[model samples]
Target: MGVSGCGKSTVGEELAKQLGVPFAEGDKLHPASNVKKMAAGTPLNDDDRWPWLDLVGADLRKGYEADGIVISCSALKKIYRERLRESCGGPLAFVYLEGSVDLLTERMGARTGHFMPLSLLQNQLATMEVPTGEPGVVTVNIDASPEEIVANALKGLASL
Candidate 1:
């Protein structure tokens, strides 16, 4: 889990492919209205995201029924992570990608075709709860390329 523009989708996809798990991009589950809000450069409040989180959680639970799954989501806060864990029916191991605000802004500026705006980035970072010593979590720095990020996550996840 990470802030938007932190390579969650890119890194998550690479990690999932390597782990041979079903990969789900959390953005695909957003409601049209939420997408619209994001496209208009508005950050979503928890109210705007709960339903969306529930939908992604459903996919994760369903995917778990078949096999291990990897998901790309901005599980930004402790509460948000809790929601996802509940939705998936228990605990979840996650790789938290972290980067500087400036780096994310640069990435966001370079990104095309995404609904989330660079403006909402500060809000995301503000809401973010770092992993700390949290169990079932591995925090990864975001400076590396997607391949390297996934590789580091894999190494960490294996230790978990």
Candidate 2:
């Protein structure tokens, strides 16, 4: 999981394919009001996020019996990550896609037919608390090809 334009959806999809697991894009679960706010270029506050985050957490918990599942989400803070672990009640690995603001802006700008605007990206970056010290997290710098990032993530998972 990572911020907008960090390629969470893209990488998660590919990673799920590699692991042969189901993939859920957390953005799809956002309430329409949140989507409208984002579509209108307003960044959502924490108050607006809790319910949706909990929903994503619940979904993660639902697949506990499976080999694994991969999902794309903007888990930007330690609190958010904790909520995820609290739901899953076990160690889970996360591949954080990291990149520069310039890169992310460019990438977000290139995309089309999405509600998240480039304007909201900076707020996400500002809100992001990189999970360097978090348990069960593998941060993958996203500047490389998706293949390379996915390979590194798979290798990291092996060690855990």
Candidate 3:
């Protein structure tokens, strides 16, 4: 969980593959209105996110019933993460993909077919809580290859 262009989906899919578990992209759970807002370059407020977070948490909880599941979610705020944790009945290990603003903007600028616009990067970064010292959070610097990032995430998750 990081900014919009923090490679959450790519890393999450790989992480799930490495762990032999199901993978869910949290963005797919967003309501159409929220998607439309972001697609129009509007930053979402708390009200716009709570319901989406609940759906993601529900997906995570359902997947967990069978096996470990990896989900890509930009749980930017502490309260958002708390909501997800509560929805799932407990905290889930979160792989916070860390990157520099420059790198993030670059990535966002290069991406296509995504609802989140590069213009909203600053707002996401601003809303982010960093998750430092937070339980079940594993921060992985994303200034490396996807393979390397996944490796780091796997190692970090194991230590948790």
CA lDDT of every candidate: 0.88, 0.86, 0.91
lDDT of 3 by residue, 30-124 (tens): 99999999999899999999889989989888877766788899999999998888777645898999999999999999999888989999999
Better of 2 and 3 by TM-score: 3
TM-score of 2: 0.95
User: Which of the numbered candidates is closest to the native, going by highest lDDT?
Assistant: 3
TM-score, prediction 1: 0.95
Candidate 1 residue pairs in backbone clash: none
User: Over 4 Å off in model 2, which ranges?
Assistant: none
List the candidates' TM-scores in order: 0.95, 0.95, 0.97
Whole-model alpha-carbon lDDT for candidate 1:
0.88
lDDT per residue (tens digit) for residues 79-138 in model 2: 988888888756678787888888888889999999998889888988999999777788
The residue ranges of model 3 lying beyond 4 angstroms of the native Cα positions read: none
Candidate scoring better on TM-score of 1 and 3: 3
